[model samples]
Target: MSFTNNIFLLMEKSLKKYGNNVHYSVLKEEVLNWINLKDGGIYIDCTCGPGGHSKYLLSSGKEIFIIGLDKDEKMLEIAKENLKGLKNFKLIKGGFENIKEILEKEKIDKVDGFLFDLGFSTPQIKDGQRGFSFREDGPLDMRYDITSNLTAYHILNKWSRRDLVFIFKNYGEIKNCERIVDKIIERRKKKKFETTEELANFICENFKERKKIHPATRFFLALRIATNDELNCLKKGLENSIPFLKKGGRILVISFNSLEDRIVKNFFRKTECIRILTKKPILPTKEEIEVNPLSRSAKLRVGEKNGK
Candidate 1:
């Protein structure tokens, strides 16, 4: 097996041994009470990361069957293990963008509630080979689905400086995109950047300085987003999912960044079929933040299909 495959194996073994941490889903958001799921109705976990939400409500949702969809098959395999010892649960290796097809395959008419936890699962970030974190020594690849050939490596090495600037400015929210672009191009000309550490070091040494955050944060974010086509995937998923939901079905999404949250909020408000459950997004409390450091950046929003 290749080094990448080895990394995946090590990550799985560690997470399984440690029994991977549990995470909260949108159902726990304070603004979430507005959208209530019926006990006997079906629920969909569109992005079932680590299966914490399902574990919490499984007994309560005993009457409900859950169908979890994800683009990453490795993660889906882990999800199957996490959801083991439970009936009325199914896992599919596919993108949420194919929600209608998944529903069709299940032969289910309409789901009562659909759940989306948009955060990258912890294991993905923790794995050294995935190269999501600056701490890890790994390839620049950041696609959640390794099977999807395109990756951060391709973009950094091949994209025009104009595209780099565009991604940094629009996706990374980083200022001085032009300078960043110039630096990336010049550095790549000397040598093709392959590893996360190599690119991160070049940005640190040659790029403009930032006291608030790492200089490469935005560029990395942009590369990952571009490689995964995340925004479009989310939009497609939502558009396809709502149609398969029962009239009164609910859609709950938890997003980590402003861009993602804004998309979810605006889509819910503008959607004709959805009654916005959270006119404003719900945020984690100070207490919640203290417990889970990642919760600090989280924002939860929900909407219900407008019928009974």
Candidate 2:
């Protein structure tokens, strides 16, 4: 076997050994039921992290095909391994923002459904080397596409104080972050913020909170959003995807943050071509939250393309 095959074999073996602990997709039943996959239908998994949602769709016994897109190469590699031998599915390393170009390139005129699960996978947060976890100390890099030039490090050390304040206030919703910004400004002058821990600790030291979540949580979130241009990307993905969805096809978005949820909600409402299926967003059941607390924040909104 080749080196690549050997690596995939090792990963497969490891997954089999620890299959019980794997992080599955959120709201599997709800998503599958709402999308209502048709026989021989084609679907696009906009954020097919580790192939969980794609696997679920492929297993629906509808003889459906899937096109999975993700910006993270590591996630795509794992997705390829997890989906090994699955027929009629293709995994591409690209952001959902480029869905139009991707579909055009694939010559897939229209698809039955589009799924956007906007949450970081467990592997992403657990792997500190990727710099997503505030709990684990590592480099400040937080690009979903590693080849991307921007990183959390660049934002923290190089961005102007005004830009930092804007992100924290708007993206993070942390209204009173002047002290924190002032401290980051002061600290970066002497020694640039180079690691997740350094930035997390600095935020915590400057900003105190009595909430269940860490003080650095929103700060880190804002940094990740700014670094990845996540909000803008979501808008582009949603806007670009509608034209390619077959009439009567549906779009399901699982957003983990209020901002993303709001965007999906408003998009579903204002788009004359899409009929909002759920007037209110669906939340994870208590059982799901009990099983995986990380799922508590997830909100699923679905819309069907109208024939208009």
- Name the lDDT of candidate 1: 0.75
Tell me the spans in candidate 1 whose CA falls farther than 4 Å from its real position.
1-35, 209-211
lDDT of 2 by residue, 1-308 (tens): 54333433454454466662266588998999999999989999999888988988888888999999999988988888888878889989999999999999999988999999995886787678889878768999888899999999999999999999999999999998877899889999999998888888887778986555677888989989999999999999999999999999999999999999999999888899999999888899998865555677899999999893
**Which consecutive 10 residues in model 1 have the weakest lDDT in total?**
23-32
**Model 2 residue 31 lDDT score:** 94
Shift in Å, residue 283, candidate 2: 1.0
Q: What Cα-based lDDT does every candidate model obtain? A: 0.75, 0.87
State the lDDT of candidate 1 residue by residue for 1-308, as single tens digits. 54333444655565566654433343354523534657787888888766766655565534677777777776777777777888888877778888888789879877788888885877677776897766567998998878889889999999898888887787787777787688778878989998988988887787764545666666677888888888888888888888788887888888887778888987887788888877777788876754455566787788888854
**Residue 25 lDDT, candidate 2, scale 0-100:** 81
The candidate maximizing lDDT is 2
